[model samples]
Target: MPQMFRHRGFTGRIRRNYPMKKILKWTGIGVLAFAIVIIAALLIIPMFVDIQDYKPRLETMVSEKTGRDFAIGGDLELSLFPWAGISFSDLRLGNPPGYREKIFLSIESFDVRVKLLPLISKDIQVKRFVIEGPHLVLEKSSDGKGNWEEFGERREPEKKTATETQQEPRADMLPVKTLQVEECAIKNGTVAWIDDAAGTRNTLSELNLDLQNVSLDKPVDISLSANLDGRPLSMKGFLGPVGEKPGTGPLAFDLALSALDQLNLTVKGKVTDAATAPRFDAAFDLSPFSPRKLLDSFSVPFPVKTADPGVLNKIAAKGSITGSTEKISVNNGRLNMDDSAISFTVDAGEFQKPVLSFNMEVDSIDLDRYMPPPAEEAEAASKPKKKPDPEAGIDYGPLRKPVINGTVQIKNLTFSEARVSDLSIKISAKGGRYNIEPIELAAYEGTLKAGAILNVQKDTPSASAELNIMGMKINPLLQDVIDKDFLDGTLKAQMSIAFTGDEPNAIKKTLGGSGELLFEDGAVVGIDMAGMVRNVTASFGLSDKPGEKPRTDFSELIAPFTIKNGVVNTSGTTMKSPLLRLVVTGNANLVTETLDMRVEPKVVGTLKGQGDTKERSGLAVPILISGTFSEPKFKPDLKGIVTQGLKLPKTEDLKKALPGGDEIQKESLKDSAKDLLKGLPLKKK
Candidate 1:
């Protein structure tokens, strides 16, 4: 038994120890040697492989599939261990038939490196990927087809049935579990659009891009610089932490972009569910810059001629936008144009027939500044004027689709010679009809409340308005509108009008409405009753009449009118005062802008403190006004005054009525009244 034990030796003890440590050590050494050999073979074998020998086969294979010539003109190099990589230079893809250019795409150099071990598990860890001097040309063939079209097998892709399409899963997540990239760059790449038929060529060239620290779980820094049609453009940004599953989660981005060295924009945003239903919230800022200089840099003329040359010189905007596939909203929006600033908010959806709601407010705006100046009369007359082109009827089809609800407020607004403050307009539109409800403004020491409706459902669009103006100073209003005043009053008016068409002449001809205007304690300039009575006495020396001004005063005046078929008729216009009572009836043609009116003044009221008895009677001295609105001609009705005064019972009674005038003096008053009716003739005195 002792000898048997001695022979067995340490075998029993080795079994007891289990020998696991030695087995593991030898297994590790073997693995290390095997790995070293494999790595060495990978590093050294490629040195003699001469991958160029396969280039012809690759080219032929690609050309056969694409139906285009392909070639590699430079050596291909490969590296293994440290990083697995391939690099090549001077690769070209030939254009399709009927193109003048021989090559459609050409790459000067390309290189990519990745971790090989991770690729075995289908995960890519890119170390360096670079493309240099890669140029792509998009050319239109003589047949109007693009050179880049109809590539690969000339067969349409299989169309999936509804069931199959619904069952197929979209590739929102990459095949790899993770992606890590250290460096990625595209250097001096270019794309060109050439159309020989149109004699045009546009190129985006010198495109250099770099991406830093790109990973599925970490933000990537990106910088890009390029020239678009000879204009410089650059962008730098941070994007993503795209997560392990791209297009499945939110992506955050912040970027700054500059174009043409004139405009700079910054964007910060987050996007979610990008592959299916993308939703985004973003803030955008555009730094102040000169729009004129930017357009000039592009060699493009300004789009509109403006009265003020300094306008549109600087413009900027900032806003926040939130949107999904179904809806979009803009909030906290600010826009600056020259000296004007506006803030607004907007929400929109239903892109096919858009529905929109918005609120906009402007601190101040001068519409006249943006409008083209009127031509001087001399210049307009000297130019050989062409007959105006016939105006085309407006197309209301587009208006029928959009639904709008909005309000606009302007603190100060100026148009032409008029200036208004606190202008507020609430607007709504749907189905071809639009309403501006309760438009309110302040002007000329008065408040104007108005509303308008525009209906485009008819072939000829129609519009109507209702207006109320209260406590207005007509002198200032007239002075602002015409730069002169012929009358003074405190005006109160209510007006309603309906009109068809969109031109001044058309509106005037089609206008129909009713309105009433009241003037309190006002004067009708250029017509003086007292002056006319005194003129006859002074001429005949019946009595030396004191000098009187050429004016007619009234305590209260009312002019009520109705308009139809472009003619304005007023039968109820009357004036009352302590001295005289006046009645006026008139027809004014809006289309022709002419006036035919009659006025009768009576000095029948008992002239208190005039040394006269209460036996006052009604008398009439008629006047006629007939002329264009711009130049009215006025004359006294001499036949009624002169011949009627002769029929009086006595010249003494007539003299008492005429403020110390005899029968001859009364006849002279008739002649002088004619001279008094003309505003210009009496103004010289």
Candidate 2:
């Protein structure tokens, strides 16, 4: 019974297996037949079908659809075997009616090959794509319409409602699942742009572009070279090793660019969520190059003529930059120019009411090198001064909107024949108020500490400053600044000043300040005090400073001053020297640049050290100084000599009446009498 049951089960299995095998065989046969028929159709259609015969209908259809004349001047070839491809020559597209040049675009030849099977998966794999000897023209008519304007109809774009715009992305967010190209190239393409109204014509010619390893999953190498308006330009780059979902994830790029063979640059970057909310981080490096040479390559003049021809040569920079829709940051930034280098970082955002911040450090720089060379003496003298333009005035409204903060430190800086060391500056601004705080620098054996504020909240801006200088050498400072060294001393000074308005002349007229200046162990060059004292009437003026450059040596000089409404007043400025004592009082008119001063001088017969305050034993000659600062006049106060209490007191009365009546005081009085009478041609009583 067991053997019989086994036999039946085996038969049952065979029965089921036979039908399954037969069904599989029939399915295979049907698939092979379909494939064979497709292959045959692909091979036979091109051979038997004369696609050119339908060119007129095809051209007519295209012309009607595109609203432009289209034609194929040469035979069209088609292939469908390993690569589905088409090749044609002498294709032309015409512009709309009324154009002088009817042909808008023309091509010598175009060929393309694409894999057909990939289309089923919504993917494109381009086997080969090539274009050769294509030409295009963009012409602007007198009415300002271009040949490339709207093709078939002037239809406004369909505007979506707010709700529609905010809708979720459709399933077909991307045009294709993936794109891959084995090779693509364009050669000898040209484009011409003509503007009839402007009477200008420009052309881009000899354009070549090539791409390799082009795939969504792999980096694509691209290169292009072209000539633009007779200037050469080239670009080579690699884009993407993109994520599986292109435009949703990271994409990387590296590019090198050059123009006129003079400027060379490289850029590397990455972008995330490129399609939705793109964020990018990039690095840019500029190779050492001459900016002057770059401009010259394009037959453009350098912006300014510099004192040193080589100043702007050899500049290089590298920086890392990152940006989003609302924010931008630059880090690891470095700039190199010849021997100078700077490191910096910057951040900016909120452009509507702009906010900007930066920190920078520079090793050394010479600004004078970049300044324009001095004009010729004769040319400068002959050039007419420009009249003030009433319309050219400051618009401080823009300053009121933005907020800015910055700090800069320079180890060494040189400009205008002056050198500074260890300079640091901090600045901030908001709502039309600007502040510069802790501005410190060292120059000419001196250190300066200063701060300033500018308020433009109102129509007329106002400014104020506080500055202090410590132990600075005046001779070298003046020599470097004005090429003059009429004063030699170590100076200490402090000032606080304020003014309104931005114009220099207006500011000077409105300036108000208080300051004190002290000079130690110095000489007033070009002045002779002893000669003035000896012959007061013969040379009453004593030239204040003779052209021969005689000088008066002083141990200490002090001046304290105040300014109001553009006038400076100094009530007591004192100078002590071995042979003279001088006191000066003056009001200097800053608006008119004039001086009104009184100087009292005393010649000492028995000189005392600067520290001693012995009685005055000398002839006093009061003098007046008046004129503009540029050409001051000095004269003795003859009226004062005739007026104030010079009625001679008897020698006994002078001794008893003077304060203290000390023996030294009495002797000084007697010596004054003897000297005045003996020195002058007067007889002694």
Candidate 3:
């Protein structure tokens, strides 16, 4: 029993101290020593390497890749620790030989760091990349050649024999599958662009960029800040994973941009085939922006001034865009400018010479805010300036743009003192000719329908319009359009007018058209024809008293007029009242705003009838109205009144009223008969 126990203990001890355990322990010690030695070598090797000796090779490699001369003016640095990295200082690359600029790109310092663990797996994982103080110059020569274009000679691959081509295995040129950058930063960058042909030079400075988690498998956050033409700009965005095939992958993104404190924009979307033929559905928001401030920040001048300084300040828009490289469409677009709100859709075709179609509706817009101030207008008018020739200062340049087809509808529109509601206009243009047809509006208690054609293809642009105004109040309509209230009534009118000029004054001077005006239960406000007749007769010692206060109230007034060379002529204008009738013949010069009219007034016998009477008891007077439309002079023709007042009595009245007139008349008649008979018979004898 004692011997068996001793043998079992011996076997157990042997089993405890096995050969595999000893081998594994020694192998671990060797691996530790080797790792230490390797680490020590990595730390010491850079000290003796003298990286400057490799400068020529590095420069040559860069030059070959870029097709330009490259140099490292300062030292090259290397570090070996948790990661390996190489850094360069004072590096410059020269432009193509013939370019006017000496250097294409220059960097004060550049650094790249790679994780050591990834190197074992043949995967390049950059820990950090930094570039400081880089300046790039881009130039375009007078001959339209750009400095960045490829200028180096290319070597074509030698053609392979058919047998060799079959023998070669198909393989990708670059086999690296995984690439990642954890962080990247660029600071104090500058870019300059020169266009010799255009004689323009532009520079951007103080540029900075920062990136985090830059990889193909996760979202990358990026931030950029720059100074563009003295304006500060900033952007922040996140881009979705780029995937294995970077350009063709679907991407989701969100970006925000701010410029000079004047504009702010945000865009969020998903894009497919991001880098080539990208198709995207995106939502964009731009708000709290000022167009005027943007222009001012860029040192650009504004062409017009508004009455309210804030009128163009608060512009905002929200919309969705769907597009590819060749086409883009904006849908559900909502815009707000000051007090106006507009919704629209725009489809643009043919990206080069874009054909645009738009449909828009505005809730309300007060155009008066965008017009010149009244004080400025009055001051301009008060200045002593030469009368301008209207035809000399007109420009038709805006008509030469690409075609535009659109429809615009406005619920309410206000201009100066005029208010219009429910206004709609259809517009189309092609080849310098534009048509604004089916323009309908509700204004001044009536409806106005008009269409206009403007042909700017000629040296002098020609405009034609046809208008129909129905059941309009003449007083307010005239006051709004022409600042005159010459008549008051409900009016129905139609006009077809045309003019050949681009300037307002020239068009007025060249106006030619014909129209008819019909006013019912209206009155001429400025002067009374009946009052003038009565006053003239009473003054000439022929009538009782002047008629009532200087207004001619008529039950109906009708005038059919023709316009020629800016002059409006009416041959027969008739006005009928309860107690009087008037006929007016006149010519009004629209350009000069002058009136030359003759008014003949007659008193009617019956108060409630529409027939002419030959009663001679009432006075007849002819009045002359001449002067400007604003201030006209009404005068009676005294010679005509006196001639009319000295008329003889009728033949019957004279014969009946005379004393012994019957006997004298019989004797005179007998003598006249005898004389006539004797003359006829005596000629025969």
Candidate 4:
């Protein structure tokens, strides 16, 4: 039996392996038959199938799921193998009409894989893709009844896996498990980020992203780069669920990103709990942050003055913040900007904190180069009409810069400065409002203490402070203030001002605070009160003392005056010759720069009983001033007499009798003075 079976080649010795020719011929036939079936399916089946209906069916399914009207124009074609994909050419989609909704999405060329099986089997695969060249458009109406995000509440995620049917995951499908994605790439991608809430639209160009080896059981690695607003930024990161758990899985990540020429940032973060409530901690390091450059990148204009151009080049910052569901804390924070440094630590427990502190220090700043121009000067310069002249008109106020350097003490803060440009301040406050204490500063010396309440909500501030002067010189400050029109006196007064205001003009108007103004041995500049009094007396027929020569110097004109609470009171001092005694008291409203005063003049130290001999013993002058500041109406009238009451020398008679009238009148005028004084005993000598 075995020999018979072997002769038929059904057993034993394999019958010397069938003839190679016959074996190969059958294999070729079988392969040819398989190829024929495949070609028929590829070339003929798609032609017969109604692919147009698939478009509406897809549209209906989308509409049903999203509760939005969906429509598509044109037929869809699905190819079978070898170029295996779905194609939609000249396709247009929109939100259905007649529903106050407007949405339109169009595609010129699109193709997608018909099956995802190959991708799951570790092969390069894609499902449904689109390629549009410059003509694709998406539109949304202002009313917001449009596409993707406008869909109603999202469906709940499923918690199970799909069965062997190998269908697309439905809304009710199980939570994703063991998701795996192989290499994916994009080229020349462009996307627009639109924020309807903020009404902002930003476009990113030349965008590229590469994602590799993403897995739910493993870490995900990604790299992306894009050109944003003419700046290049690149980012790389790795992310994963922590501890290899699902509901309990946390997030762990490390990322590095930077904008070209502006800033570089690196961060590491982790979330410890994904269920109940999440707890997270993150540390960030930012380096080479240029304030000017960063602001410029965002199109913000900065008016900073730099000694060396582009000196504000770099800044570095490091900080870490940790927070649970209810509490948060920060530690190890430091910020460095050029030569400046700031550091702080803060911790909070559900908004309840007892101690918080901050400290800052600045190396140096130039005040004169950085401070803004005076308000009056800036305003005058901006006017197009006939602008007011700074010096010709009255400028009630002009700003003065003070030299500022030293440590500042805040509640829990201490800010130290090496030197500040163009700033001088004398500030003090009482009763929670700045009320200048009576003080005079010869020169602003060292550390100053500030008192003020800064109300950020109202965007208003009130401050008062006392600048402590250890030992300083005053000549320079006094000279500068005098030159700047703060006062019109050669007198040097050492004083400090305590004032509060949001503006320079306001502070100037209130430049008054009760501070002692000490005058050294300097004389009054351009003020000759004695000469004025002499003229008044001469015009009034008031006689000079017999032994004394006429007075010329103005040092004797003004008696010392003290200012307090807006009142000026002359000291009780008597002048020597002509025996004039001045008694003046009045209030000077500094805001208006007006003086309302009463001047009483009396004779003293006369040879004879001048007071009794003269018809008037005292001259009470009522002074009135009116007009714009620079040129004012300054008139002083004797209480009982007018200007006509004064006696005048006979100038016409002397002029007619003199050849050298201009010169002889001067000598004859003296002889006439001798004649006019003939009756006095001193004149006889």
The best candidate by TM-score is 2
Give lDDT tens digits, candidate 1, residues 140-248. 9656889878888777789989999887868684777888887899999999999988877878999999999788889999999999899999999999999877898
Q: Per-model C-alpha lDDT, please?
A: 0.81, 0.81, 0.78, 0.48
Across 468-565, the per-residue lDDT of candidate 4 in tens digits comes to 43323233333443232111212322233344445545554534333333322233332223333434433222333334333322123333444443
Candidates 2 and 4 compared by lDDT, better number: 2
Q: lDDT tens digits, residues 1-685, model 3?
A: 7888899999888898897799899999999999999888888989878888989998999988888989999989887866899998999999987778999999999999998766877687898899999999999999999998885766799999999998775332233457789779999999999999988887889999999878778888989999887788899999887666666768889999998878799999989886657799999999768788788877777667778666887799999999888778999999998788999999887666567789999999989889887788878877886777755765666565658799999999988668899999999987788999999999888889999999988778898999898888877866775566457788888889999976556887889999888888887764544443443333122223235434568888888888988899999888887667878898988788777988777776554444545442345556666766655544455555567773433445334223344665444333321221122111210
Candidate 4 local lDDT, residue 486:
18
TM-scores, each model vs. reference: 0.77, 0.79, 0.69, 0.50
lDDT string, candidate 2, 95-181, tens digits? 998776899999999999998867779788898899999999999998999999878767789999989987957432765778888
* Model 4 regions more than 4 Å off: 1-54, 61-179, 184-188, 193-201, 246-250, 274-276, 289-316, 323-341, 344-359, 366-377, 380-443, 453-585, 590-593, 597-685
